[model samples]
Target: MYGFIWRHLPGNPWVKALISVVLVLAAVYVLFQYVFPWAEPLLPFNDVTVNDQ
Candidate 1:
């Protein structure tokens, strides 16, 4: 998958690297701004409990 993206990106290696970094940052921003917030309530990570016995 990464190979596919790397192949499709235009320009020399340095340009490709810069675009890759931008794409990654954009993806991370989207996830934190939208995806994670939407999914957080459905996930079980916060439903913590302890057995006192």
Candidate 2:
């Protein structure tokens, strides 16, 4: 997958690297801004358990 992205990016090595970084940041931003918020309520990790003796 990474190799496919690297190949598809158009430019010299430096330009490709910059574009790759920008793309990664954009993906992360989208995940935090939309995907994670949408999925947060569906996750079960917020439930707490305790034992009393």
Candidate 3:
């Protein structure tokens, strides 16, 4: 899959590296800004407790 993406990126090594970095940052930004927030309420992270019951 990575090889496929690398082949499709239209540039030499330096340009390809730059594009890959930008794409990764964009993905991270979108996930943190939208996806995680939307999913947070549906997850059980806040329900965790350390009780000796």
lDDT of 1 by residue, 2-52 (tens): 999999999999999999999999999999999999999999997999999
lDDT of 2 at 16: 98
For TM-score, the strongest prediction is 2
lDDT of 3 at 34: 100
| Model 3, CA-based lDDT | 0.96
Every model's Cα RMSD, please? 1.0, 0.9, 1.4
In terms of lDDT, the poorest run of 10 residues in model 2 is 44-53
Model 1, C-alpha of 6: deviation from truth (Å): 1.1
lDDT of 2 by residue, 1-53 (tens): 99999999999999999999999999999999999999999998889888896
For model 3, what is the error of residue 15's alpha carbon versus the real structure, in angstroms, after optimal superposition? 0.3
Query: Any runs in candidate 2 off by more than 4 Å, and if so which?
Result: none
Which 10-residue window of candidate 3 scores lowest in summed lDDT? 44-53
lDDT value, residue 3 of candidate 1? 96
